[model samples]
Target: MIPLQRPPLPEELVERMSARGERLPQYRGGARELWRDSRTIRRELSAHLVAMAAGLSRCMYCGDSEGTSIDHFQPIAMAPQRAFDWLNHLWACAYCNSNQKRDLYPMDRDGLALLIDPTADEPADHLDLVLATGAYRPRTAKGSETIRIFGLDRPVLERGRAQAYVRCRSMLRDLARLAEHAERAEAGAVAHALTVQPFADVLYEMLRLRTAPRAALVFGAETVAGLNMLKDPRALRGPLHN
Candidate 1:
């Protein structure tokens, strides 16, 4: 997962939600019932789609699967006050939203959340990727908790991530060959392969390797960022690695 900027909600949707928030006390179970309303679902759908687009169409929690639903960073049952708050919403896949996270919200002694909210914090601060296994290991308490809650170490996700890493490594190897021959056209094709989504975390790691001994020697010591992805290979890493 990576830190993401919250997208803007439509002005009218914001106003409508604000009005609904104000009327929560009038509802049967306050914000609990509000979360079940069709109007609320409509507005949330809009926001979820916007967040998905902003997040490269990936789940905000795992950063792997397509974001298929709106998730409350603080579950509605636990934090009614934030039920309609834009900042409390996130784009998530079914696995993260329904199966793993559910209504579980663990906190610290001081009442701070242990789960990493990608919108509020950089996931790199908390988590580390095991490149060989394609599994995330926690660098901090929040990272560990987020991984546990979201099942970040699940076998399916691990396999998917491993495949992504293989793709990224394959691209780097091709770029290395292309560099030897100065094959600009083939290099450009290899670069395009790196940008294809689903597991950008893998590509990101491959890019970072430009500064590392082996990859740097393969690409060149003086790595150009954007241009290298197109003309060579450099930069990429793993929390989404820092």
Candidate 2:
């Protein structure tokens, strides 16, 4: 649901992969490693863990702090050929990655994949944001399996999301009050006040707990820049209802 940057493999790491016959065919001649070199696996996976953290800045499974490993949605041990596949990896909180989702993959009635790839799209689309409980429920069978397979409804994740949703709502109300009170000429002042206002830091810190508000998370210094990019100046100044 968030913009993520998966950095390219380092040259040194690539060289090491090439040193051994690691590059192999996958997913119909996918330009990937054929066999995983032990050392390369350690180095690449470690860095990937960092990049994954850097990507979402939190655990993909539960939106917690950086987890211990890069999750192979299709377990690397089982799908060793995909050990180096880019799209195959995901950031996993330690517990959910290992204890809960160990080697388990889900498929729908027709046996198609039924899991949410955080790297692909927002989880909110197929799932509803349950404000009362902060758990994701599939409006359909596929969604249910995704919720189960990815542990989207786990108590910890639900609580974190609930807290985040509350914070986001609180921030919106706070901004709305200020905007309503400020006169049109004081738009500049209102913007400044927004920075020092409560939860401003939380809003701007792009990479944070996933339980953090996904959209409002970008209310950073960059907001000023984004304001300029808006076609209508008035559009830049609106209450945070959304």
Candidate 3:
């Protein structure tokens, strides 16, 4: 998961949610009923907005499947107070929302959410990609629970991520070869092309090997060398860095 900027809710929408919260009972059914009448829900749940916020490509959770529905980060069943809160909404695939993560929200001792908020945090902090198996390894308790709750290591997802990793690695190797004879400008163009691929996280993790602590141990020498090669001629710089 990557860090996403949470969009602000309009004042009118916030007021509507506040009013709904004031009158709604703290129960699943009541939360459902309250949201059914919410204008904010009506507006925000539109197809285009959901698609845009959901990255218009893949599921936020698995980052592989097509994102098809809106998910309540704080399920309405557990937190009726946030039933219509825009901040609690997320874009998800049908499988992740209905099949894997149906209303199962674990919490910490402080009552804070244990589930990773893809929009609020960098998932790489808690999770790591195992390129060999195409499975995710938990780096923290939150990551472990998220993997379990979302079935992130299910065979289908594992296969998909593995395929993506292969494609990402192939692209990196291609870029490295091209950088040898290509001008700095040409190498930059190659890196830009890499970003447009599906499962861009694979490319990102390899790039992060440059700065992340113990990155060589985490990602290995070849991965670090590939990224360093790209950075040598400034080929693999982020858009902002470039």
List the candidates' TM-scores in order: 0.78, 0.59, 0.74
Residue 103 deviation, candidate 2, in Å?
A: 0.5
lDDT of 2 by residue, 212-235 (tens): 444345343333233322223463
Better of 1 and 3 by lDDT: 1
Candidate 3, 49: how far from true, in Å? Answer: 6.1
- Tell me the number of clashing residue pairs for each predicted model: 9, 4, 0
Better of 1 and 2 by TM-score: 1
| Collision pairs in model 2 | 22-34, 23-34, 24-33, 24-34
Among all candidates shown, the one with the greatest lDDT: 1
Tens digit of per-residue lDDT, candidate 1, span 98-124? 999999999999999999987789777
lDDT of each structure? 0.70, 0.53, 0.70
Q: What is the Å distance of residue 216 in model 2 from its true position?
A: 15
Q: On residues 65-120, what C-alpha lDDT tens digit does candidate 3 reach at each position?
A: 77776688989889877776677887788899999999999998999887899778
Kindly report which residue stretches of model 1 are placed more than 4 angstroms away from their true locations once superposed.
Answer: 38-56, 172-193, 213-227, 230-242
How high is the lDDT of residue 200 in model 1? 66
